[model samples]
Target chain A: MSEFQPKIVAFVCNWCTYAGADLTGTSRIKYSPNVRIVRFPCTGRIDYMLLTKAFASGADGIIVSGCHPNDCHYTSGNFYARRRWIVFKKLCDFMGIDTRRIVFSWVSAAEGSKWADIVNTTNEEIIKLGPYDSYHKLSTQDILE
Target chain B: MEEIKKIARELLAENKVQVVLGFEKGTANKVRPAFFTKAEDIDKLIYNEACIHNIALYLKKDTCQHAKGVAITATPNVVRSILQLSAENQITEEKIHIIGITHEGKCAGILDFKAAEEFSKTQPKGLKPEDKALIEKIQAMSLEERFDYWVEAFSPCIKCYACRASCPMCYCGKCNVETNNPQWIPVASHKYGNVEWHMMRAMHLAGRCINCGECNRSCPVDIPLNILSYMLSDFVLDEFDSEAGLNSVFTSALSAYTVVDKENFIK
Candidate 1:
């Protein structure tokens, strides 16, 4: 059959990665078409549950990007987001979730090319990882008899 | 045991506290939570190692909330919970009295919040040996194996919510599971719903669970829910150097942050 194309969900903050992706489009920087972006007010606004929801909804990969440290528009939102992701990432790892499929990054609005690079590289990695079939089987199924 | 009863009697006799939350003999020699309001009723009060239940959860109940003054027989776990709750502003120091029981099951007498904080810190915080073994086993599995492991582990859940009810930290009036507007969590106890409920529960309690193991004790299916929270708390401590139930001024690591937090994983 044809090559596998993973469905990647990108959760980006309005002030940074979303704008960065917009810049990528404006600058005509071509990246993988595999990613779908979801914008939030701030990195702090991107509830960690959304990440799980993405996975449970058959997303093969996820990108959570926000402002760099000291660069958040709301001052400390990214900082708080950073602390949360550290523990959240650890818990996901401990729970046997394929944390490798989830990418956490900082993409300032100026980093248009950087956002494209992130999308492309993450797409390649997830292509190698293949579909998140195991997770899909577990969460989407109704129940065991 | 008499020391606790005597203290309870004195507190009741002097009208110091409206109720003393402790344990009493139950049917089949089991110890159950018993609240004493009368001085003479203090005769039923008891304290033993079997009293591992985190009685701190009672503070939020109507019995304690409506009372002018309250005292609780606090094991190490209960003391930590009391401190954590106070730090979260769920309750105040002046309203609740802590009858401290150390890790050794000895009554340390009534302690103020300051002493309770110290008592919590000094108590042993290691995971039970069996729990440690299971954690290690889960950690050793490949990612797929771990996912399957949890699926199987949660398969027997009946959605009884005993874990949330027994946990002192899960004090939300209407849990997210109850919100059907968007249906954040599935209401059914099926495999998928069970996993989602537990993941939601774990994240909510990430920086808050005090390693009390009451959730496990309360689970009818005996799912290893406690180990999940324990692992999360251990990581929170190792990475953030903050712990729950250690201080009354409770800002969990997740709720606050340093600009310099480790983020090597962020690409």
Candidate 2:
């Protein structure tokens, strides 16, 4: 009867966003509980398949966060990731997927406040969008039936 | 084209090469690739203005293993496709021979391994007038509009996989689309499946496609499938200034990296 809380999958780069989330914990920063953080070495390591996988696994929103430009641990990893994300965003748009469900952000290892703010803002946006109905339709529930 | 066939037959009769790969007339004037194993079969090999399909797709098949060498009718895109395949280890340089053809239907010459290597390097200076016009047209559109335009153009796809089947660079035995354990793509021909099929194929070929136009030519529904692949290939070429099928020396665009590559999209 009531609105459902959206599930958010946040793929945070281990060297930057994950550390920033750690810092957020240490700083006692408050944020939405909707997001589940999955860490990667760098955003460049995130496969386009994994983004779709998260949605297929019932995440209403997905966030891919990494170090700010000129701050990648692998020097050019974020640059490669940036170029790939541009194509991925365009592909998502063309697929008729709601682009707002997938968010790309740069949260530095020191940006604990920014990480908390991003999580809260993204969570609020997802809540308004409701459950990811399109992705859910591709779930195992349909396969089982 | 007739002169080229006569020379091919002579070479095969002399046992200079074991196989001659060329086009034969097909239904509705479509040119389908024909393999000539015996010198007598060489009479069937034909080429004309309509020989557009990249016949390189058949060189790596199981049937080609017994052949001493492959002789293909070459266009610029066909040459480019071969170079890319050789570089990727799909076929060896020594296993193939190229018979280059001018647009005017003359056999430029038979380019063996060594000559093919040099020919790719001698890529003509300055962009073709058609390429310049295409680039200008593409550049005039907004990114969102371009995305929308491609989606409409790709709507005719039927998931036949003919495009994938005919591509030289698409040599994987177990393609991503066919994986079933955790199916990467739907098996049906819905709009979502069709769009995803094209997008996934285009993405996989981002840095590898050589603008051969084989995928577009092979499409049954006449989708401008090459535009997506060509756009990505152009992006990779401009960003890294690397040519995909020209030589084996340069690292693939997606596989290798530079510390100075652009990162404007990252916040």
Best by lDDT: 1
lDDT of 2 at A23: 97
Interface RMSD of each: 1.2, 5.0
Lowest lDDT 10-residue stretch of candidate 2 chain A: A136-145
Docking class of 1: medium
Query: Candidate 2, after superposition: displacement of residue B22 in Å?
Result: 0.6
- TM-scores for all candidates: the values are 0.97, 0.81
Best-matching candidate per DockQ: 1
For residues A36-107, could you state the per-residue lDDT of candidate 2 as single tens digits?
Answer: 999999989998888877887789999999998789998878878877886666546544556788889999
lDDT of 1: 0.90
Lowest summed lDDT across 10 adjacent residues in model 1 chain A is found at: A136-145
